[model samples]
Target: MTDKAKQYLELFLVFFKLGAFTFGGGYAMIPLIRNEVVSKRNWVEDEEFMEMLALAQSAPGPISLNTALFIGNKRMGFKGGLVSGIALIIPSFVIILIIAMFLVKFKENAVVERVFKGIRPAVVALIAAPLYMLGKSANVNKKNIWIPIVVVALVAFLSVSPIYIIIGSIVLGLLHFLYIKKIHKR
Candidate 1:
């Protein structure tokens, strides 16, 4: 095989492993993706990975797939994006297909119910671990720590839609950037 073909194969396998193993969705996959792309394979630097994550979250898709596409495009091109995305979904599609085939039959089984109950805490932990890591990556610190807390509260308690929160954050971020630029000019 040519070098490009081999590289594509490697990308497919890496994302396949990620999709097959990660639980609790994309958020839970963050750290693993970080480790793979940044630390292990040296595909992207830490800062670039974080930036890809930000864009991935902002886009209207599963963060994991979005991030994978970003990485693939960065590495190869549009075709790379297609390859990575298909690879990412294949394992998940197969698993979910299998589960759906028997879900109605097993949905009320005591053993299955207990298994799901036990998995809930594990899933939560999986999700939370990435939050802490991503917080650090995003440079969340004492002065800015309240931002996420407030956003979470607003969404969780007030029942505010996240679209508004995202829009508001974009405006605020641009305003902050302009303000800093003005100060730097002076």
Candidate 2:
């Protein structure tokens, strides 16, 4: 295979594994994805991953799939995106199909329930791992710590829509930029 073809294959395999093995959806996969894409593949640096992750989180879709598209596009353009997306979906699609077929049989199985119960704590850890890592990566300091805490409270306690949160953040960011520019010009 040509270098480009090899790269595409690698993208397919990597994303396929991520999709297949990751149990708690995209957020839970962040740590593993970071390790593979940043630490192992050297495809992007930590800062770039944080940026892509921000963009991915903002967009509608699984963060993992969106991230895969970004990495694949960075490496090989449109074809890369297509390859990565399809590869990522295949395992999920197949697994879902198999589950749907067998779900009735396993619906009340004690062993299956116990297995899922056992995985819950691990999944929570997986989801929480990225929060600490991303917070450090994003340079979240004591000064800004209240921002995330407030957002979480709004979402969790007030039941505010995330769409509004996104819009509000955009406005705040623009205002901050303008303030910085004004200060710079003075």
Candidate 3:
């Protein structure tokens, strides 16, 4: 195969490993993905990963699939995205199929029940860790900091739908851009 093809294959393999090991879902995979793709391989930079994550969130489908597609495309091209997306999904699909069969066959097993119980808290912690990291990485300052707080309050207090949250964030982001533009003009 060509160098580009090799790169795409590597992307697929890495993500396949990630998909196989990750118990939870997209949120739990973020930190592990970052560690492997960003820190270990240097395939993507931290800022690029964050930006890609934002794009992935706005796009359709699962975040992990989107993430693999984004990074793979960034590295190799369209072919990379196709290969990586397929690779990331295949393991999860197979695992799920196996688990479904096993669950049907052994629904009453105490061992299986206890294993799932043990995994729940670890999955929660894994999800929480990335949230903490993302918060720490955010460029918080007096001017723009309140935007998140307000958005959170509106969501929590008013029970706003997530679509509204996306709309609100977009408007706020544009306003922040304008504010900075005005500051630069002055």
Q: Of the candidates shown, which would achieve the greatest TM-score relative to the real structure?
A: 1
Candidate 1 Cα outliers beyond 4 Å, as residue runs: 1-14, 21-63, 74-76, 129-134
**So what's the TM-score on candidate 1?**
0.69
lDDT of 2 by residue, 131-186 (tens): 98889987899999988999999998999999899889889999999999999999
Error of 2 at 28 (Å): 8.1
* lDDT score for residue 2 of model 2: 95
lDDT of 1 by residue, 97-186 (tens): 999999989979999999999999998887677787789988999999999999989998999999999899999999999999999999
Candidate 1 vs 3: which has more TM-score? 1
Residues 132-180 of candidate 3 have per-residue lDDT tens digits of 5676677666777787788778887888887888877789779989999
11: Cα error in model 3, Å: 3.9
Please, what is the whole-model Cα lDDT of each candidate in the order they appear?
0.91, 0.90, 0.84
